[model samples]
Target: MKEIKTKIIERIKSHFQDAVERDYDYNRLDFSVKKETIPSILFYLKDEMNFKHLSHITCVDWLEEKEFEVVFILWSYTDRLQVYVRTRIDRDHPVLDNIDMIWRQANTYERELKEMYGINFTGLEAPEEFLLEDWEGPPPMRRDFDTREYAARTYYTRPGREDAQDVRETIIKRTGEELPDFAKKYKR
Candidate 1:
């Protein structure tokens, strides 16, 4: 397994000199590359290497860094290995090339990322809405989107629950036990 990993790492590094090898284990490897090299690297891995399965595509919102990390995970049944191709894009102008032509399932992941993370996948032909329909608020998955604030502003309180005591207070009262100081701050 170690030999296979070393060979794969060498192959990738030799082909893409800028590719940075990141954390890995016995079964997984990660490579960080510039956003522009994503299409070529994925093509090389899928065609040259035996990584034929597109496991999934995910995004991470680095709020403090003002960037978004887009990760493309792939799997190889023959080698029993997984590779994560990671790239970071500017949060203010998140744009990426659509790779649906390489793997058709990429459409679904791209659509979800487009709707949820505001990522514009150039040439991705999909419906405007994937999961969220008629959503007027900011991308809900983003770290800047406040769930509590959105709920309070968008939803109305139930007619009977307005005066309801905090659940913790009720539990403490019924059990005749005092809540710890840390739990008291949650009282509304």
Candidate 2:
């Protein structure tokens, strides 16, 4: 198995002559493939290399770098070669050829990345309906997507008491019972 991994890596390395493979934190080998080679690499994996299954496609919105890093993790039941093909793209206009042609599973994952990262899937079917149906805010998975800010804007606070007063006050109002100090701290 390890021999196959080394050989497959060697094979792909020739294609991506300038690419860099590193041991990323999470105990996964990471390959920083070029933006342009992404489509070809995926096709090679699916067709010639026996990686028939595309596990997932996702992106990291590196706001600091002003780039969005894309990840395509591929696997196969036969040879069991798992490799993560990665590339970086401009944040403002993250356009890439859709890999749905290579793997049909990429369709759903690309759509997910489209909504979650705000990264365009080029020519893929992803309407802003359902799931994130009313999401008019920043892409939720992006580094800049602030949950607190989103909550403030999208969520409505009801008139009923929620963190309006302490639990003791609410209990006193509802049950008309006084909670002893020590027990009050422990009880909900």
Per-candidate total of colliding backbone pairs: 0, 0
**Model 2, runs deviating above 4 Å:** 23-28, 127-130, 157-188
- The local distance difference test score of model 1 is 0.92
- Which residue pairs show collisions in model 2? none
The sequence of per-residue lDDT tens digits that candidate 1 reaches over residues 1-188 is: 89899999999999998899975587999999999999999999999998999999999999999999999999999999999999999999999999999999999999999989999999989866779999998889999999877987889856786446577777776898878889767766
lDDT of 1 at 107: 96
Using alpha carbons, what is the TM-score of model 2? 0.75
All candidates' lDDT scores?
0.92, 0.77
lDDT of candidate 2?
A: 0.77
